[model samples]
Structure formats: structure tokens, C-alpha cells
Target: MNLFNDAQSRSDSFTLDTAIISTRVYLVLLCISTGILISYTALTPHMSTIIIKNPPKKTYENLLKEYQSTLECPCSKIAILYGSFVSLSPVYHQVCSSPFISDEWIISSQGKSFTTKDSKAIQSFFIILKVYCSLTEKTVSDAWNIFSQSVLITSHTISNDELTIRTTDSLNQFESKTATEFKRISSLIQSYVATMFSILESNVQFAPYQSVNNNSSVNFKLMPTTQGNNCSCALNNECLQIITYPGVTIYDIGVIYTVPT
Candidate 1:
């Protein structure tokens, strides 16, 4: 009887020991798994944070690239809708109330009402007036360009007096007897003397901010030029060209230095 009792106690103790060993092994495995999970979580790359390492913006060429890139519309993007609205809508307020300033800087103007007495004269007048607006815009653009080169030395802030002087100088040069000078100055400047005032109207201000200035000249090798970028020499049109990066393509715009009527 004693021997049987002792055997029973020994069997019970052995079972308990086995369970304890099994539990210890399971606990060790669990600890190792938890450590691995923690290490992996700490080491894994955080995709949410990103850094774009572009060079500093310190030069005119770099600033020009950034400015052109940011210009969502040189004039306004609403022109397409405005034109469609003008064509389709019976609502004059919805349509013609806001006129389109073309990408080419041509504005739909409200000219004098046509007179029945002079149909051909009226038609010619309309054409002339349209041409005048374009010439006016080009004049402003030229002043901006001239002033931009000047701004490289002077303040980015353009003064009214400075604009006036530039305009006078431009106009005087235009009146000069040299045909090439006149043509060049005219191509370089605007038509309405007032555009000299207006293009400088509340625009043309830029200062280098460490926040957004990327001073690297556009890698023309990486992003090569197309025939369209040479539109300034070709014809007076807005040239939009594509620039390809790794995964995406971007567009940069070009302008014709002159507007021919």
C-alpha cells in the first residue's frame, strides 16, 4: 500500500514538473518573439516622413525656373470657361461680365459700338484696338524684363518713378532714327504708354527666401530643351513644354518677346 501511494505522489510531482517546464519554454519563446517584433518596428523605415534634397536657390536662372514653375496661369485659368460661358450661356453676367485675358496676354476688350455708317472703318477700328491691347501688354512685359535685369542689381521692389524713366527711355529710343533700334525697342517695349504703368501695377516683386529658393540652374542636361522653348524667336505664342523627372512630368512656359499685329 505504501509503495503504491509513493508511486502515485511521484507520478503527480512528475506531471506538475512537466507542465512547469512546458510553460517556461513557452514563456521563453514568447519573450523572443516580442523582442523581435520590437526590433523590427524600431528599425523599419517610416514612409510618412520624406525629404527632398534640392540645391539652394541663389541665382537668377534658378529663381526664374521656380517662378515659371509656380505660375499656374500667366494671366488666368478661367479663360476657357469664360469663352465657353460666353458662347453657351444666355446669362450675360455669367459670360461676358468677366473677360478672358489670353495666355498670350490678349484681353477681350470693350471697344466703341459699331456704327452702321462706317462698317469697314468700324471693322478696321476693332482690329486696331485689339492690336493695341496686345501691344500694351507686350510693352509691360518688356519693362518687366528690363527691370528684372535691373532688379538683379537694384531692389526687387519696382518704383513708379523707375518705371516711368524706363518707359521714357524706351519711347525715346523707339523714336530714334535707327530702324533696327526702333524695331528692337518696339519689340522689347509695349504700345500703350500706360502699360509701362500697368505691368508694374502691383506685380513684379520677388525676394529670395530660404524657404523656397532652389539655386540650382535647371539641369538642362537632365531636362533638355525642345523646339517649343525657342518660341520667343519663332512666333509670338505661349509655349508650354514638358519636363520629365523620375516618375512625373512637369511643364514650363515660354513667351515670345514680341507680339506682332
Candidate 2:
């Protein structure tokens, strides 16, 4: 019985020792695994990050050359109008605003023999001039709006001087085109007006002009003189001479009309 008890105690002791050894081994493996996990977590972020030392600076010219047409810089104000940058104010013929074109002047200028047809024709002439001026301004404004819509700024970082330098040729071309268009329209208007009044020949006698000392015959004068003082219509179509009629103090910068000779 004593031998059996001793053998049982030895067996239990051996089992406890084996269990302790297994527990120690498991704890050591767990410690090793936790250390590895912590190391991996600490290194992951740094592994993905990249650092550059003393990078070279890039210039606009160099970048433009490298990227060619594929490069683009965003603008803060993308939908700006041309009027914001440019102002187009047209100066109309002085006659349009002068007292000579007024209703009072027209009525006072008429003689006793002045027919209704003659009065109507004169009024219509002034009206045409005023309309043309208004239409020309509107047409140019619309053209500028369309041109502004088409313009694209490739670089937002560029200075105003640099942008102006780059776009000078394009702006000049647009101005030339606009001027050409204005000239064409002006020519058309002049031709139309001339044709409409062709029936009234230069030699034809109108109503007896009482405005100038009760003159019996009214002479329609056609003076082909241009603006003086280095005025070239080719360079500027608006360059016109101011004409003053006899016995009138106010100067009339006439577009189509001329002073009586």
C-alpha cells in the first residue's frame, strides 16, 4: 500500500511539472508574438512615408517647356467678363448731340415753301445717324462678350505683366478685327444713306431758304474735304473734322453732312 501511494504521488508531481513547463512555453511564445506585433505596428507608417532632401525649385518657363499643352493652372475667378478688364466707350458724331439736329432747329429752319416730305427726310437722316451709333456700340459689346468667353488663361500664377506680354498679339488681332468690322458696317450705312437721298441732286433747288437773308435758291453743297492735322481715316475712322455752318456759333462734328459752301 505504501509503495502504491508513493508511486501515485510521484505521478502527480510529474504531471504538475509537465503542466508548468507547457504554461511557461505558451507564455514565452505569447510574449514573442506581442513584441513582433508592436514592432510591425510602429514601423508600418514610416515604411509608407517618403522624404525629399533639398528638392530643386522649378520655374514657369521650365515647367511650360516640359509639360507643353497638357499643363493647366486653375484661376480664382473663372467666369469674368471682358468688360471687367476692358472698357469700350464709343464717341459718336457731335451732330447727334448738337442743337442742329433738334426738332426746334428743324422747324425754325423750314421756309414757307418747305414741304412735309423735305422735313421728314431731314428728320430721318438724323434718326439714322443716332440709330447707327447706338447699334455700333451694342454690336461691339456683344462681340467683346463672345471674345471673352473664348479666352482661357493657362496659368493663374503668372503676373499681370507676363500675362499681358503673352496675350498682346491676340488682343491686337481682336482690335484689328473689330475695327475692320466697324468700317465695313459704317461703309454700308453710308452707301445706304447716299442711295436713299440720291433723288435730291446737288443742283436741285429746295424750298427758298429764308434762313440766310431770304435767299431765293438753296444750293446743296458737296465738299470732299477730309479732316486736317494729320488725320488719317485708315488709322482711325472716327477722326472727323468739326464743321460750323454760317451764322451758327455751335460747332458740328458731322459724319456725313457737310457745311454749305
Clashing pairs in 2: none
Residue-level lDDT tens digits of model 2 in 1-261: 122344455579776566667767878898999999999998885523233333233655565566556544545565544445655565766765776556676555553233544443554555565667677777688777667665545535454566677567657877788889888988888666654544432212344334454575455544332347765433444343433334433354334356221
RMSD of 2: 17.5
Stretches of candidate 2 above 4 Å error? 1-84, 100-121, 202-261
For model 1, residues 124-153, the per-residue Cα lDDT tens digits are 333444554565455555544443343212
lDDT of 1 at 238: 29
TM-score of each: 0.19, 0.42
Question: lDDT per model, in order?
Answer: 0.39, 0.56
The root-mean-square deviation over C-alpha atoms between each candidate and the true structure, in angstroms, is 30.7, 17.5
Quality of model 1 by C-alpha lDDT: 0.39
